[model samples]
Target: MIRLRYATMPSNGGSRTSTGTIQTPPTPMADTSTEPEVQLRMFSQPRFLAAVRALVGTMAQRLGFTEMQCGQISLAVDEALCNVITHGYERRPDGQLWINFWALEGEPTGLKIVIEDLATQVDPDDIQPRDLDDIRPGGLGVHIIREVMDEVNWERRSPKGMRLTMIKRLQPGRNSELKNE
Candidate 1:
């Protein structure tokens, strides 16, 4: 199990953003097949979204992702987190959400971001983006996430809540490699 502590600072409960940094090094776990991950936990509030965006963008850049790729990854992550804050936590500012960002190793390296929340359980099959042709302001987050991410999956967590996993391939020809013949 992953252990992390997030220190919450005072916020205006509006547009202000609070960031909690985890200085702990990524340690190899028993599951050797996957790479070690850096964990981040923060309050589920609108104000903290900016901090999450910055963290994911910086991590992507440091992992050799181009400016465009970093932006795409950040936007996708932002949408995911926003969904957790809005739908999962039901806009409760005091609720907590956990995120794990890591890079895959070996043959074809890529980025993976996992967001877990304990507010509500969501069925993967029930998630549906609004029709793009409808052109509405309130329902495009899911569409944007799908367009930007190479792979997007929603998993119902045991006990409660759900986990949203978003992956992006940094290589040029990753699309072809990830596609089935």
Candidate 2:
């Protein structure tokens, strides 16, 4: 149970047909840049991660993010999805989650990644990155996403579930840094 949709610019050459539809040349930008660009609905399954990563990475690349930044963006998203499956769904493969990708408009152009799940409600206070000194094999999703994205936050939904939001903005000269705010 997984579905993904992205707003891709028209690939048709800039032309007008008898149908009275305008088809512009494909640009590096996507229509989602001005609105909610991508939407993904998926089950709590690990098998779809690879495809998701590829799509996300390509989207980031098209958004004019650097190669390294694109990779980081995809990786952070993967980590977030894994966390939702592992923690929110408690490893239940059938639980459902919704993911949305948004392009922000401002002095610092950016992308916003949001994931919502109804599998379980988590206490925000209990969500913390494990000590890095321990060197554990897992439980590092939060740390990875936080370090990779400019802004990150986790919110508890009413009655049930959780929502996680992460954003990355291209700063002056396309450099990136975590926004402590």
Which candidate wins on lDDT?
2
- State the lDDT at 78 in candidate 1: 86
Misplaced by over 4 Å in model 1 are 1-35, 173-181
* TM values, all candidates: 0.76, 0.78
The TM-score that candidate 1 achieves is 0.76
TM-score of 2: 0.78
Q: Where does model 2 exceed 4 Å of error?
A: 8-35, 175-181
lDDT, candidate 1, at 151:
90
Query: What is candidate 2's lDDT per residue for 40-118, written digit by digit as tens?
Result: 7777899988888887787676666788988999999999889888877889998877777876656687888787777
* Model 1: lowest-lDDT 10 consecutive positions: 23-32
* lDDT (tens digit, per residue) of candidate 1 on 91-166: 9887677787767655467788887777788779989899878975787889889999889888887667777888
